[model samples]
Target: MRGVVLHAPGDVRVEERDDPVIVAPTDAVIRLSATCVCGSDLWPYRGVEEVDGPSPMGHEYVGVVAEVGGEVRDVRPGQFVVGSFFASDNTCELCRAGYQSSCVHRVPIGGIGAQAEYLRVPLADGTLVATPGTPPDDLVPSLLAASDVLGTGWFAAVAAEVGPGKTVAVVGDGAVGLLGVLAARQLGAARIIAMSRHESRQALALEYGATDIVTERGDEGVARVKDLTDGLGAHSVIEAVGTQESMMQAIRSTRPGGHVGYVGVTHDVALPGMDLFFSHVHLHGGPAPVRRFLPELVDLICDRRIDPGKVFDLTLPLDRAPEGYEAMDERRAIKTLLTV
Candidate 1:
């Protein structure tokens, strides 16, 4: 099989690799039908995250189950499934509480590399959500999106408490943030503000249901949001870019006693205890418990109620993953879908 491997900064390659097989009785090996490059993948490609060796890449995937371990009864072979980036037993105490990403047996799937012909999913019964049927080619992208970005964005919206009569602000124009805008809209946010400098992204955000767009950055960005909200700030803010500046912008853009749901992978961000206390904003985020929302998101996509797949502006063959990574890194593509 061939898959993506990251050797160093700006160094990504498609090369031959050993095929995956079920090594655990709780695992399932699936042949990937569609996979994509994630904003988080850029962390290692750009050297923001340490890479000690040529490591496997990719996590978001939708595929047909080729085989399932003896212990995996719910997800059978031949079922089309969408799964989270983090595999979980789905039966753990944490999973029962809706934090599958922090399950006692949680496993990060990136190391397994979904950008390949096949992937071995641990906790198969819990991590993988089977679609209604083999989704049509048209619905594949949307289902794939549910595997990660859509689910993560939905979790962000829920954490932020986006609902009817509330003004919501999304800080980040990436795929996840755009989807967060969509999530906010579906959750009935009365007003959705998207903070983006790129015209293309701004357009997509509008199409995704954003009522306003703010191009300013840092303090100026917060001021614009506050101005729009009559100096009280948004009722809820979703921070999709994990940076000190973006985090602060999100914090400042939320009204006192409002919620801030941050899903961006934190790199060098550290919040001041005093500032948080004074801000009086509720902050909740971490690796999104995508598994908790997969069932509902899958239903929404299958029903054609939402079209999250629009986030993938570029599609490439799995073998051309290098180009996919480059396009996203250069901001030439909002998101890339790699077909196998």
Candidate 2:
């Protein structure tokens, strides 16, 4: 088997590795059919996030089950499945309460990189959700999208309570934020404002359901959002970029009693207590509890209500994942899909 490994910053390679096997009763082995490069993967690739030794690299995946442990009954061999980045025993108190990301037995599903021929999935019954049989060839990308970005965007919309009669603002024009606009529209948001300086991404955002596009930066961006909302600010703001600037933009663009649903993988960011206190805005975000929304999102995709896979502007072979990283880091691609 071959998997992606990061030997150090700015160095990603495809190396031969031993295949994974079921190690626990709740485990399952999957042969990846499709995988992708996430924005967070760039942190290590760009040398922002330190990497000591060789480490496996992907978290979003969609594949066919190769083997299942004795205790894994819900998922079986030969079934196509999609799973969240975090593995959890879905029956835990937190999971039962719809917060699988904080499950008592939660396990970070990072060891077996999805950009590989085969990998192991822990807590199969609780972590993996089987799709409606094998989907059409074109639907594979959409199903793979549901494994992470789509679900995260959907969670962001739900967190912000985006629905009919509300104005929503989305910061960050990355894949997640673009899909957040789509999710907001699907959730019934009357006005969807997408803040992006890139013309290509802004175009895609419009195609996905953005009611307006604002190509402003920093404070100007916040002012544009407020101006569009008649100085009251948007009722809900989705922060998909986890930088300090993006976070502040999200908080400042939202109305006093509005909510900020942030799903960006935070890095080196510090929130100002006084600013938040004075703003009276509600903040909620972390690793998205994707499992909680998996069932509904799966149904929506299966029934053709949404096509989040459109975000993948470039596709590459698994062996050429380094190119995918470069394309994203250079801003040449919005999202890259790797076929196994």
Query: By lDDT, who's the top model here?
Result: 1
Candidate 2 residues lying further than 4 Å off, grouped into runs, are none
lDDT of 2 at 64: 94
**Which 10-residue window of candidate 2 scores lowest in summed lDDT?**
106-115
Q: Candidate 2's residue-wise lDDT over 177-293, tens digit each?
A: 998999999999999999999999999899999999999968999999999999989999999999999999999999999999999987988999999998899899888899998
Model 1, runs deviating above 4 Å: none
Residues 1-340 of candidate 1: C-alpha lDDT, one tens digit per residue: 9999999999999999999988999999999999999999999999998998999999999999999999888999999999999999999899999999999999999988888999999999999999998989999999999988998899999999999999999999999999999999999999999999999999999999999999999999999999999999999999999999999999999999999999998889999899899999999998999999999999999999999999999999999999999999999999999999
Candidate 1 yields a Cα-based lDDT of 0.95
| lDDT values for all models | 0.95, 0.91
